[model samples]
Target: MAEMIVLKGLIKRFGDLLAVDDISLDVKRGEVLGFLGPNGAGKSTTMKMIAGFLTPTAGTATVCGHEVTEQPVEVKKRIGYLPEGAPTYGDMTPATFLDFIAEIRGFTGTERTKRVDAVVETVDIKEVLCQRIETLSKGFKRRVGLAQSMLHDPEVLILDEPTDGLDPNQKHHVRNLIRDMAANKAIIISTHILEEVEAVCSRAVVIGHGRLLADGTAEDLMARLPYHNAVAVRVTQDNLSIVQEGLSALGPVEAVAEAGGLTRLRVAADDGKARLADVAGLIQDKGLAVREVFVERGRMDDAFRDITKGETMESLHQGDGNA
Candidate 1:
């Protein structure tokens, strides 16, 4: 896949505060990059520069090989941007708003109508098409914002909190649309939502204090958790003590509460590697009758917090796959 979005040494400053500091990243076609950071972490600042809405204090932003500063109009033509809050003309109805956007994108006559209709259906905003944007529910307003972003079918999409106000169904629909579009476009979505990244993003980037802190696939990030590939064993209460004692030789054992006449024990890998087979073999040798065993994928929520809150990535490596 071609690299469609690139930022090098990107910096943003307001008065004495540096909003984005020496950040850099690239998004390739067929990839959805989750741009994540805590509140006031400069995620949106970096995005605004990439989308040509804010000029960088230093460094360069590029889209489709066009430098954002040198070729703002060309860059805009190739990107679809959904800003924070999904701002729109509150007085305009969805129908008029989409049509107006289509016209602005150079569509005409039947082509314009098709674009408008396609996005309305894509976002499932048909029912609210005739209502004013401000008058619609928050979810409906968000859908309208989404419809406008994709109205021109731009090759790159920069969505800030794409599912911000969406309900479950709307979020699912938008995420599915993002996945479907990933094969053809390079997408950068700024969101603090962890599951959203896991669901649609092929790569995840973490920023904190206005600096690029981590970047990798979601699995890579998760692998840094203490129990990334840890083993889980479920057995009858009778075997619980034996299993716990035996597993302790391999790594720390955390026992979960008993349920349904069974006790669950989780064993973290000492070497930060998947050791399920090693554990299973131990059970086999001991003639232990275990109910079930599985490898854990680790906790994403913990990983996200560790990655974004910490000052340095090296100190937070619970495993080797640090971004």
Candidate 2:
């Protein structure tokens, strides 16, 4: 697939703070790339720069071979942007707002009318097309914003928090719409919702503290973090220490926590393989009646917490040492 958007060492500063620090990315045609980060993690700043809404202090960005700063007008024409808040004219109805946007994009006559009607139908805003924007619900307002963005059928779509404030049905509809549209255009979806990545994106890019942390498929990112296949065992007695000792004899137990009359043991082997059977055998040999046993899969939230916390601790240690 062709590269629709490219950034090299992209940097942006606000006074003494570096909002985006030396980030680089390439978005390909017909791909939906999920942009993820914690709050204030520079995800929005990076999106703004890519959409030609903010100028970078250093480095460069290009959209369809045109420099963002040098040819913003041309770049804007090739991209459809839905900002974070989905701002719109409160006085104009959906149809009128879409018409105004179509005119700004240089559409006229039947072409403008056709495009507007098509998007209104695509986004399912036809029910409230004539209603005043201020009177519409949040979900309907979001649909209006989406209609305007898709009005020109731009090759690149930049959607920031597209499903914010949407009901479950509307969210599902928008997710499906994005998936259907991804076949013909490159999309960069900036959202904190991890489930959205799994639902609609082909790949994901995770950023932290104004820097890129991980970029790959969701499974790839999950594999990079440490995860132990754990076994939750419930014993007849509440002596977790005894169970912990017995489990340790079988293998190197990474962690043992007791909760709800059960000892959850995370065992680690030299090869880091699943040792559930070994764990069960150890419990049986110890004469402990296993009331229940189950394998627990590692969660993405655990990986995210470990990575971000480790980075934060390292930064704090460095600062303390310097002081």
Runs of candidate 2 exceeding 4 Å displacement: 228-250, 253-297, 310-323
lDDT of 1 by residue, 135-248 (tens): 999889888888889999999999999999888888998999999999999999988888999999999888888977778888878877777888999988888888888877
Which of the numbered candidates is closest to the native, going by highest TM-score? 1
Give the number of colliding residue pairs in candidate 2. 0
Candidate 1 TM-score versus the reference: 0.89
Number of clashing residue pairs in every model? 0, 0
Which ten-residue region of model 2 has the weakest summed lDDT? 314-323
Number of clashing residue pairs, candidate 1: 0
Segments in model 1 whose C-alpha atoms lie over 4 Å from true places: 234-240, 249-251, 255-264, 270-272, 281-292, 316-323
